[model samples]
Target: MLQESHTAVIARGQHWRGEVATEPYEAAWAKEAIFFLRALKVEGSLQGTRANIQISADGIHWADEGSSLAVPTTAGEVTFCRISHFGGFLRLVVALPEGARIQVVASLNLKA
Candidate 1:
């Protein structure tokens, strides 16, 4: 099971990586899942730049699941991403435009 608490940054910058592993491995699989990704805060000046979020079942391979939300610097905070119709163990990876430093928070909800 994944902890309810937020996991901190595994890496920061243009390319960031983070992973959440399921314990008691057999129970991790679910019929449906939703992942909530929130950009808690951003730094290092995000002028005319955007960020991209990606997910992978295995860390080595990744596919663009698409951004659930995008926050232009001029807009308010709280960017989100949602991935539905997924099963098995999962991992998330974030890619920011060059020279962008940002921190995001994410959580997972599973339904059997």
Candidate 2:
């Protein structure tokens, strides 16, 4: 006779965020989970810098989850976008002007 094995995993139910530069950044992969946008922080000196959010299932092809967000050229500026959706994977695609440098951070509330 053959038997099946079962295991249980405790859901993290925690929040996670990733930081990236203007050169383009991708977040870590998340398994069978849902996420909610908490906040976005933009810092550093640059011009016409923007942060774009994207989601993917295989990490090969990506789709824009939302519109491009404008980033302040100056520091001490934060944008709040509270959106919720379920995805197998999530990442960020940043756009910067020529010779522009900026730092972007995204926060997400994870649920299993």
Candidate 3:
């Protein structure tokens, strides 16, 4: 049987936001997991210089798993990518380089 556990809470501020979590299971059960991340309904008059999303297993350590996902918005909502991978732990980090306040919504799906 496959199961999931919430290991962290993700909240976004006016500038940046992120979260991390881990799920333990038999390594032989599955090889990888798929994470669907999105940046939705952002409203503002600021130019987003850059937006980045990344994942990590150790929590303290991280890797640029979802780097190519970025959307520049002056108004309206924008969606990013559907990233899939395998790891013991997982985290989501988003950065807005322009320093403008941004509203973001994100979620993750884990498989093992």
Pick the lDDT winner: 1
TM-scores for the candidates: 0.48, 0.49, 0.50
Model 2: per-residue Cα lDDT over 24-104, one tens digit each: 222332223222222233333445555566766676777787755555555455543333453555554555554445433
Report the C-alpha lDDT of model 3 over 1-112, residue by residue, as the tens digit. 5464331224332233332222322222334443333344454433544444445555567566554445436434544444444455444454444434455544443344
**Residue pairs with backbone atoms closer than 3 Å in model 3 (clashes):** none
Clashing pairs in 2: none
Best by TM-score: 3
lDDT of 1 by residue, 21-105 (tens): 2121111345544454444556555554433444556544555556434533432354445555443345444345555555554
Q: What would you estimate as the lDDT of candidate 1? A: 0.43
RMSD versus native structure for model 1: 6.9
Mark the regions of model 1 whose C-alpha exceeds 4 Å error after superposition.
1-28, 44-76
Sorted by TM-score, highest first, which candidate order results?
Answer: 3, 2, 1
lDDT against the true structure, each candidate: 0.43, 0.42, 0.42
Instruction: Name the Cα RMSD for model 3.
Output: 5.8
lDDT, candidate 1, at 55: 50
